[model samples]
Target chain A: MDPVTLLTIVVLAVFVGFEVVSKVTSTLHTPLMSGANAIHGIILIGAIIVAGQASDVWILAVALLAVVLATANLVGGFVVTDRMLHMFRARKPPADTNTDAGTGTGTGTGTKGGAQ
Target chain B: MSLLPAEWTALLYLAVAVCFILALKGLSSPKTARRGNLVGSAGALVAVITVFLSVKLDNIPAILIAIIVGAGIAAPIARRVQMTQMPQLVALFNGVGGGAAALVAVLELGHTDDPWVRVAVVFTMLVGAVSFSGSAVTVAKLQELITTRPLLFPGMRWVMSATLVAAIVACGFIVATGSAGWAIALLVLGLAAGLLLVLPVGGADVPIVISLLNAFTGLAVAASGIVLGNVLLVVAGTLVGASGTILTRAMASAMGRGVSGILFGAFRGGSTAGSTTQSDRPVRSTGPEDVAVLLGYAQRVVIVPGYGLAVAQGQHTVAELATALEERGIQVDFAIHPVAGRMPGHMNVLLAEANVPYESLKEMAEVNPEFKNTDVALVVGANDVVNPAAKTSPGSPIYGMPILEVGDAGQVVFLKRSMRPGFAGIENELLFDPKTTLLFGDAKDSLTKVLGAVKAL
Candidate 1:
């Protein structure tokens, strides 16, 4: 493809893609944007791959550095996001009381913390 | 090898710009945000594919591998993250964008002998690194893996100032010398500066921090795009940066703080030492049966859930109780405060998970008026948002923070373990009110018992 034609196709795609994205409502935003943002990190990988393949020694060195930095961003971003998600995970406290149940029970005044 | 015409390329660029505009517009309303995302992504796809079409790379496999690897990691993580931690997740994602831009700039600098590219590259690296680290610290503070309170040292402001100055000086040297050594030093200093900048911010300030960092990422990405001469990058980054800034300012104002206060860590005084009336006056508590009796006889019951409800994982029990009450022909509604729980829409997500009907969940604005008609306002582990101090006490840390008007309800039943103050550390005056009855225990157990008692009655 000619440079002009290829560039034109890319630009057209951007325009249509932008329009479609704008249609997403506030309700869909949190989930959609989150997914979108994660995908956006692909740029790092792209830059790295592009850099890794450069013919010149200088380009190759630059690409290698890009790979390291971008990888840090990707890894760090994933780790933090995962941790944050854990915070929101619904965890139900087990219905245990101040008593043993292994031998069918022991001492208990009831789980004292059970809101009166 | 190129076969495309110039006019087509120009048209495609215009189309991409349109997609960007549409995506932004759709983001304005929740109903359209999904479609907007699709539109924006399509534009990105077009841009990427067009790049492929124009320039045939020798190693297509490497490019494909990069794409696959990136997606494989990000997709699962995003899928696994829950809704409640979205704010921090957002911060982390923004950080990645900034970091990526910085990395790209650094690589370009390493490869290029041109002074202009080198200068732009340095700027991108500084901005991106700072944005990334700053966002990371904000996420840490918000997640409470690190303390939400400011990590202040004596003369902390001066220290932060000095670090920033050093970073700027280092950046200057890197640009002047065009050496990787200076660049490496500058990166470390910049990272430190970012941490110092965000460390003093408390958890309450995280929303603003997230927004600001988002803006920083956008701007950094945009600068990198300019350096790389990528039009799509420039357009996308600019839109995100601008929108992020606007959102940040709006959120800061909502918390009654300014941008400067947010930046300088001056607003940490929100947690200032204030006298708390620690009432040892024993709470007149009731059992599940007694509480159930009142609720069963009541015509209207409003369920108020807070962070405690979340901590105890009592939403299902709460919903069951609501169902039981409804079965007995008693009216039950969930009253959700805007800033309830840790994040926006936290209550909604919890309730939804428990299969509570969406119609039964009412926002503060919609439910406050009904409190007067409510027979019993059951507060489950909620504190700051329901505290009457928001309206009654000027000196209270939560003063001016909007609260639920559950006080107007005929009787208030508090399901609490103890009188520990909430995130704001201010005692709930509602606890001591004559009309309020404290039901002290585990929220889930209390709720389950209440349901049982109501069913029995």
Candidate 2:
């Protein structure tokens, strides 16, 4: 808990962060931003601790507000990031009449026939 | 005072910090990104649980209620938000984090009497409040609730500098006297400074501004950590601060502008001056049928997409058109600029949603050379990235930035709504080149018409 030790940890973490993130390709930048946004949502812990210790009514209200905002930021960030990442799926199988005939689905036949 | 022994808590904090780092490492590659996100969330879970275990509480019910309410609001927005709105969503989430950090710092002021703790509290409050307000403005701009253009006025720089000086002076006063009143004043001034900082920046620079604000929030969290003596917060916060800073710099350089220039230079209105003269040049126009015929016969084609593509919701149609072209034995590839969409990788996400193959998507450096061999370069709703002005016109705002060499192709087909310039408000000379033909209409409508025309041929 020494100030010097915390400063040392901060400095070293900066180096590690820069090294890891510099390698990120441009295509993944949105997820990278979103993930980091969620990471900083760690501030939620500070909110919880502060709200729990509040004695005055006004201070308690402010602390509760903080807790709500932090929670929203934390949960919202990660879920949105997951949603975005889900969209980056690999290419779907090509539409082939032979494959569609084997499956025998009416919807599948309609789509393939429409494409042609 | 602690539920767990001090050493045990410290060990857990170390584990949490490791998770955070490994999470970022996983994000560096597409293959491991989801797992990385999971790892980071797990670390957050651990950190929150640890806080509950360690802190002695008077209002557990209130805290739980707040958490539930917050999650109730955030979860739905995250779930239902369209992909095009992701940048604004991120900005809004970022604003909440900053507001939370600032509020936490304000609450800590009464609990701590140590001079160092008081100083850290003041630092946290200032940066956190600024980021909160600044990010709000960014959200409004991105959401189109306000004009996305720079809102500059005469003497704006002087007003901003004076406000910054006042905020710093107030912070020093709070640290020196430990007065609550000075601390409140500093927060207000800081919020004003944040607004002033972001208001004059144009829309093209919003991604960089968001990154910078994200870093500000990180530092604010770190300062809060210092006040609370939590090493995990300090480490995690610093890591985010560093990462955000690096990203902001990379994005700025990618656009060939410095951070200071982006913040202040555009305000002089020099970038938009020459646009009128450039627009006077005659441009060649082509219809969708002609475009389809030209594309139908080309052996190889490249598509360059920009923010306009997202605006038109044309990703799915464009992908379908590419497939149609490919069916006719024409090779089709996509060239993505680093800053292509509203955010980085914005186009990729949109295209991927339409099931465009990842292998067919190429970066600027990799795809620029291929343009020379391309029989037809199809630019869909993208102007700035393919603007030859970036390489040739010294007076252009986008000059000196790397661009797609679509002009080198045998034929260039541009799909635009009109002769309007791009986001940077600069005319694209590439549109006027003899090799280039403008196919004007809504991108999706135009692509659909072209698809039908190609089918007929």
Highest TM-score scorer: 2
lDDT digits (tens) for residues B60-173 of candidate 2:
989999999999999999999988888898898988999999999988887777888888998899889989999999999999888777887798888998998898898777
Cα distance off (Å), candidate 1, residue B132: 1.8
- Per-residue error at B75 for model 2, in Å? 1.2
Interface root mean square deviation per prediction: 8.1, 2.8
Sum up the clashes in candidate 1: 57
Candidate 2 docking band: medium
Per-residue alpha-carbon lDDT of candidate 2 for residues A45-105, written as tens digits (9 for 90 to 100): 8999888888899999999999999999899998888777655544444454244223333
Candidate 2's C-alpha runs over 4 A off are: A91-116, B267-269, B272-281
Q: Which runs in model 1 stand beyond 4 Å of their true positions?
A: A1-116, B1-24, B27-31, B38-47, B56-60, B110-120, B174-177, B263-270, B274-281, B327-331, B357-360, B389-397
Of the candidates shown, which would achieve the greatest lDDT relative to the real structure? 2
Best by DockQ: 2
| Candidates' C-alpha lDDT | 0.65, 0.84
Q: Please give the distance, in angstroms, between residue B355's alpha carbon in candidate 1 and its true position after superposition.
A: 3.8
Which pairs, if any, clash in model 2? none
